[model samples]
Target: MLTCDHPFPLDQYDDRVKEHLRFTGFYHASQIGIVQCQKALVNALVERWHPNTHTFHLPIGECAVTLEDMAMILGLPTDGLPVTGITMSNFETLEAECLHQFEIAPRKSNYRGSGIKLTWLRDLKERLQLTDENNIQSIGQYSWGSACLAHLYRALCRASRFDCKEIDDPLTLLLVWAWIRLPYLAPVPREPRSFPLANM
Candidate 1:
């Protein structure tokens, strides 16, 4: 049983947490319903996911803020980062497609298309059962899960460079990334309208 309710500081770093989530099919790539973006998972992924190019901080013209800065703003863990974002190129992204799919099931829905559920995420313990995928599919509501999707989205951000306006706070910029990626659960340049954040 996990005890840390706050899920900050490093609770998510606990291997048990990752195992729990993964077993619950959190890492399962076929399930296609909405899952809860547990703070534990988000904090863990932010801490675990590789960094974007620029040494540590994201480049904004001449200024830059680092993962540590973003962690500080969000009150998350900032130590022991391992990011390949700086060199995350199209080739690497292409290479990782199969691995990514095996690790995470990309939502098969289009931007504002179908297969979105908004019902309350059931008990993680219950969902952990490895039976069928996308149990939330039957719920008919939109899935509000974001942590897994966010990790994938962040990967796309790293693999490609998008023209972003000057944003002062790294926290706000991170949130903007989340807002942009979360809505459609996608991060790509398939079309300008597909991603509104492109203009913002």
Candidate 2:
């Protein structure tokens, strides 16, 4: 099975934690942020029909907090960390190393014929379209960039084949490229009166 490792340092500034929560689509609750993010991400992956059998190798300490602690924090089942091995924190450049490994990982068997069946991209596109129609302004370049990358990663992960070559179909390639380049485009601002303001 194709495995991708993402090692994030939770020890970084508080902003990093918030950013991680935002990127992973989980509420930034300190007590359960890590586990909530993990569950949200995993659930999203499953919703995309990614076979539940795939492996996720999460490293504790440097890359992230311990899964046991995460579970306790989230009040979830403790299965001794979902996957087999956790990455070590001793590695000096953990993120770079994990990304390098991800670049070469083989494709999962269950995802052989399917090419990018990610709903997140569709959802993002709808949100972007709504933003354009309503003239809603995005938070910043970083937020947009992160969203674009998330869409791209979802596309790449789902489209990947056993040979690791994304499907060469023109439409799929075009869509993926569009998502990747979304950050470069001008922001679409949300129009005034798009929604009724609540009374303070």
For residues 102-169, write the lDDT of model 2, one tens digit per residue: 33222232122333223433333333322231222222212322232334344445644345433222
| Candidate 1 ranges beyond 4 A from true positions | 1-61, 81-126, 129-200
TM-score of each: 0.23, 0.21
lDDT tens digits by residue: candidate 1, 91-162: 445335524533432233311222222221122233344434464332222221333234444543443333
Candidate 1 has its poorest 10 consecutive residues by lDDT at 1-10
| lDDT, candidates in the order shown | 0.32, 0.30
TM-score of 2: 0.21
Clashes of each: 15, 10
Compute the lDDT for candidate 1.
0.32
